[model samples]
Target: MSHFTKCELKMTNLTALKRALEDMELDYTEAQANQSVQVRGWRGQTLDASMCINMGKYDIGVVSAGDGTYDLTADWWGVETTKGISEAEFKDRLSQRYAYHNVLQACEGKGYTVEEERNEEDGSIQLVVRKWVSD
Candidate 1:
């Protein structure tokens, strides 16, 4: 029997996202972040998946786990917001919006039930997406 694993969709900004990807040394390129691309795990991995950036905000960015997912951001044209928005508030709002849209679209595509759980204190959201696969 094969066990199924769940993937977590953590929301962040573009600069941070880039930094994290670079730090992990994940093989990727800057293609609008929202553009669809097939993501194959490195080093003989079996998980072949696709992803795109669903949103980006200031130094933060959000991505969809699909090829045509939106690479949307709250940043002002690839630049951080200068509208006198605090760093903490900026990150929180951007992350929440990204989470909302990301899960909404993902679940809609899957045609499955989705339950949203929000963390107001941290300004984050999670979607309990129902996915079933048989081995």
Candidate 2:
């Protein structure tokens, strides 16, 4: 319960995370304000999460790391055995989308317009942003 992997993910922006989850079309539930939900784990265990992604047998918990960041929590074994989705795969997918949303938000805040977005054959995303200049 509340097991966070040492992956290269440090979820800081809840807005970007929500956008990323929506981009991935995941079935998830966000807790109400000032409340947390239970995330099902292995061996009938559960952990509190601000948001939970349902994966049938097990759920991935999005919990606060208490360090101004959020980390993912779940029983990897149960999730993999039941859903056949590896931790690395989940991390990769979520990381990419999360970064995408984060980048877009940053660009927007800086008054940049996204000109083009393309997905490479190698599964990488390319984005082009522009800002108009006036004299």
Provide TM-scores for the models.
0.30, 0.90
Instruction: Tell me model 1's lDDT, rounded to 2 decimals.
Output: 0.41
lDDT of candidate 1 over 42-80, digit per residue (tens): 232222222322222223223443453424332333233
- Scored by lDDT, model 2 comes in at 0.88
Candidate 2 TM-score, C-alpha based: 0.90
Clashes of each: 18, 0
